[model samples]
Target: MKVSLFITCLTDLYAPTVGMAVVKTLEHFGCQVDFPADQTCCGQPAFNNGYPEHARTLAQRMIEVFKKADYIVTPSGSCCAMIRDHYPHLFADDEVHQPEALEFVGRTYEFIEFLTKILKVDLTPYRLPEPVDFTYHYTCHLRGLEMTGDPCIGLLRQIGNCRFVPLEKAEQCCGFGGTFATKYPDISGAIVRDKVQCGNRTRAQVMIVNDGGCAMNIGGAGHRYGSTFAVRHAAEIIATALEGGKDNARR
Candidate 1:
């Protein structure tokens, strides 16, 4: 498939390796991936904060940037959910742009969802060096957009010797709602603190997350709170598993 990588701004900065891994994994599956240089934020930051004008402006920019792609994929589920789930409402008032916005929605997908749902990737070749206990967190946006199976777990299960350490509150929000954390520090901190406690209770060596924002939020708090767990992106963990656990060497 001809794929265009969204490369969310947060991932581009805080987690470039995840973006790189996404590329490598897709290429391994014979996808022709293209990164459009002109892409910018998916306008989710502004949209979530009730700034429709600013959000709409960036939405238009993004639409124009990836207009020709056969399928648009991004490592961050939050960004994909923003464009796929929210952009239509951003342009609903304008009849002219609504059609284009809807068109964009049809071709957008979250990274793991694309692999499992669209590509039907054969995971028989992927394997881990040894079995390791791990847990995954689903960001708010991902759970909101994805109504079915856990794509992250589905992909992770493909790797031999890796076992999922399930979290009882796996669906709980990690308190990283973009500006929500900044606007309400106390509430955000408390919620994420509980999340860390829960993950640490699982005794999982690493916590896997799909959204860049969630990785930063939960991962950052995990460090601050001294949780006995390392935070990693799904792409990173998957790429490592595919490489026979080379990512473990870095840890």
Candidate 2:
């Protein structure tokens, strides 16, 4: 399968390794992955901030960038959700780009969803080390996307002796709604405080989530507040497995 990777803005800027990990994971499963350089921000920042015109500009550019791919895959569920679930609404009234926009959305899939549902790739061959206790923070966009949750949990379950710690309110937002964090710092900080508290209560060594924005918010705050737990993306965890990390060590 020809898979085009949409390295969302956050990954391209703050976490390029996540993009590399995505490529490695796909190739590990025998799929050919390509990165389209023309791809830019998925425009969720502006869209969520109530600037549809600017969001549409970037969204249209993204659509054109990956129009030729058989499948479009991304690591961030929030960005993927923007393209898949929200882009169509952005072009609903326009005939010129409506069909193209819809097609672009149709071809896009979150990484785990594509791997487990469409590709059905077996991950056991990656050789993950003895696992440690960790919790998963399912981002709002992922749950809202309505993709199957089993792929993530099922893959993690394959790790040797890895404990999947469930957060008290796993589905609740960490309150890092992109621009929301900047606009309302107090509320955002309060939300992240609770999220970190939840993870700390679990006594887990790390907190894993799929959204880059949330990871930055939670991880940054966790570091600032001297929270011992680390934050990482699911792809990073999978990369650790492939690299043979013991106790989920850094690769």
By TM-score, the best candidate is 1
CA lDDT, candidate 2, residue 42: 88
TM-scores of all predicted structures:
0.94, 0.92
Q: Which pairs of residues have clashing backbones in candidate 1?
A: none
**Candidate 1 lDDT, tens digit per residue, 41-128?**
9999898888989999999999999999999999888898888778988888999999988999889988888888899886656676
Compose the digit string of candidate 2's lDDT tens values, residues 155-215.
Answer: 7666654568888888779999988899899999999989888888888887887888998
lDDT of 1: 0.85
Candidate 1 worst ten-residue window by lDDT: 242-251
Which segments of candidate 2 are over 4 A away from where they belong? 148-150, 244-251
TM-score for candidate 2, residues paired by index: 0.92
| Error in Å for residue 113 of model 1 | 0.8
Error of 1 at 189 (Å): 0.5
RMSD of each: 3.2, 3.2
Model 1 residue 127 lDDT?
70
